[model samples]
Target: MTSNAPDSVERADVVIVGSRCAGTAAAVPLVRAGHKVVVLDKARFPADTLSTHVLVPNGVSELKKMGALDRILALNPARSTHLRITDGDMVVCERYKPFDGIDYGICVPRNLQDECLVETAREAGADIREKCSVESVVWRGGRAVGVVYRDPDGEEREIHAKLVIGADGRRSRVAAEVDSWTPYRGSKNGRGFAFRYMDDPKAGTSQHEEMGVYRAERTVGLTLPSTPEGRVLAVWMCPAEDVSGFRMDPEAAWQQKLDGDPVMADRLAGAQNMGKVRSTADLSSYYRRSSGPGWALAGDAGHFKDPVTGNGMRDALKHGRLLGEAAAPRLHDPERLDAALAVWERGRDLDTLSTYHWGNRESRPDPVSDLVREVLRTFAGQEGPDLSDTFNRARPIEAIVSPTHLVKGLVAALRRPGADRKAIVKQALGELPLEWHGRRNRLLDGFRSTRPTKTERPDWTVGNAPGPPSYRPAADPAPVGADVPAVAA
Candidate 1:
């Protein structure tokens, strides 16, 4: 073990990597609690990344807690009270109900959102160093003690701390260095997305606050109102195989596709493209181990679901706050801190699993069955809080899309003139089923199973020393496991 004697090395109570929503959110609570916190990020602030900018009411609540909601609202983000979606000939407009007095969603761009969060953390006393990249973790006595990083000038430095946090996005370096294993990984949907900002005065109708989605046979179009008065975001998501033609001549391809779509064409008639079309193809989803002896992973560093559902920002904010709450009180005791982190990690998986599966089903390139269409139609026509709950994320997804509902919808579809019984039956039985999910997970475990490579393993786990004690809590924390599965593993 390295000596703890005073040296030129800097130190803190906690060292957080990645100063985006997740990292900044976690730092807020810890620093406010009087802990010496330092946040490191590879990029400078006020930067933007590829993202779906919708924030559901649940996420708005987190922003409220951090005192960033008011500042976000000042950015002129369009307030959305409902979601408008269409499938075939059916169109559903579901309104969002108020949650704790927050009745709407917002479309704050990442540039504004990330800046606000990092600034908030700074105000709360967190030392944020931008242009600093963490190269690896430093270990002492089988536990993570610090990190080795390159400063802005490319000078290597060591910073010691009791705990290290990974808030980096999907390809998190901290997670790799700690040997975090992915227990579940969702299959690719073979879909790609191209989006651009636009100056469309008439993009939205009915309400100033609503997300408009149009669905055709194999494509989906979205019109999201952004901050400025006449600005909006227009996106088209389609099969990966179909994206190449669109990429050939982006402007012509985008306009052609828009004009061809039954719904989107009319709404964007006079809209002028404000920026170059940005495209993304590889968007697979997965969940990684959240905590180890003295290290924890938060936000996308640990779990990422498809962006089709517009849940990425929400998940990052919610999980970051939960992690902060869980770890703040136990930072001084390794055993207790690890236990708390384990609970938070498990809860994150259980809470997000249903949505993860839902996104995969929704993003598939295959056409929806007649039964599925009817199910959506039926839910849209219903008059009650259920529809609101569905759109606002107040209810568990299973409650909205249950097996019983599918069976009923299947029966209805069977009566349709051109219903393909085989396809509908196959979809009803196979798509989004829990059993199917379990099977895929088992299959992935086999394909992904292997001993950690030297570069990916921790110091203790990398060397001959027996691997760090099983982080799986020796005694399950009763409070944390009340509703989660036996083990997230």
Candidate 2:
């Protein structure tokens, strides 16, 4: 916790930008391994940010491993052991199966959750500088060496380090400076999100201990019991085309959408709104080039998925910690550091590809088809793999709903009396292309690697250097189906 003099040049083994989930998670591991780690952020702790706010069991496990779980639990956030999902006329309610001996999910706001992580990193011996803004990276011999930043006192300073990591979120300044802002694979999201808090009188009741999800035509609603007794977070996701109407009168729109879902409407009948509605329509998903000489990207800085899956925070904590663990031992050797970063990047892509596609499918504006409803009904009645395992990352999502399982569900539905066999067959035929595409992506990504080829590395020579691309969000957001070209394999 020592501060350097104003305008002085400092040095460290690793310099991390952004001190929230990913940066702090990385700093804890590096500092505990005896590396001189410096973490910087423009905002002070206990600050609010847009978030899903739900931590699946695996994310809670990461916090426990980092020794921050006790502090988080002290906040007294609501704990959910049961999950209830309602899609059209189908319903599935089940208790979460334990993963690594942990069984419940908790919803704590970012302000409290992030502060706990920051304190944990600081306690592990990382120098964390709040209200510090990094302006650009310093380069020498075609490699990143450090960063130029403005400290809290409005004085400009510099810090040289053996490795620089970007944990800064989706419009990351670090990612821009390193020329890694352009995503290699990207797609526009079909859904937009709006959320707010409510005070539920039945908070401590047994029914309130369950997390509820209602999926209706062109919309999805979530009721997650959150922190501060009697408070719950209500989230609504609607088709992108509906965002304009929502932006015009948010309160009315929020109420109207919730009322459209009978199940969610009944649950919140007596609840009181705690705040004004908050929302965003910029929910595109992408994966940027994550690593290069002397530099790397962690968390949303390098990859992002639509929040529909509610897995963003979990991946951020897990991968950020893994990045530090992989790079700590190789920092002393320039070549080894770069190689290690490339390896980590590849592993992360391989791990998340399935969920990325799954999220896109879940958030689409299409109405739930009869075939899909039957599939879910079949899954609910059967004795098989626990679907909750997909959320906890204990098993891949495809394993739970494989092609074989889908066929079995369809066959069972056809055998039912009064079934419209002709219509079901037609709908199943229409879905084959999408189903095949998803499976093909998983198979191909398994054999591919993220290691850079000779031409992929930047040519940082004096005259050949390219200026950083403007990575800022546009003034008017793009439409839902905007064209974004994907890189060829």
lDDT, candidate 2, 1-489, per-residue tens? 123324567889999999988898888889888999999999899788888687778878888877788888898878877777778767777777665677888888888889988988898899999999999998877678899889999898789899999999988899888876766555567788988888975687976777777888779888888887778888888887778767899878977897788888888888876677888877777667777778888999988887877888888888899899988888898777776777777778777877777777777777766677777765574323366566667666777677776897688768868889998898788667656665566555332223222112122111122312223223211111222222122
Q: How far out, in Å, is residue 358 in model 2?
A: 0.4
The residue-by-residue lDDT of candidate 1 on 150-220, one tens digit each, is 99999988899888999988778887777663323334545678888878767456534667888876778
What are the lDDT figures for the candidates, one per model?
A: 0.72, 0.76
Candidate 1 Cα deviation (angstroms), residue 166: 0.5
Residue 62 displacement in candidate 1 (angstroms): 0.9
Runs with alpha carbons beyond 4 Å of true place in candidate 2: 1-8, 381-385, 412-423, 446-489
Best by TM-score: 2
Task: Give the TM-score comparing model 1 with the true structure, all chains together.
Answer: 0.86
The model with the greatest lDDT is 2
Query: What is residue 265's positional error in candidate 1, in angstroms?
Result: 1.6
Worst 10 residues of 1 by lDDT: 454-463
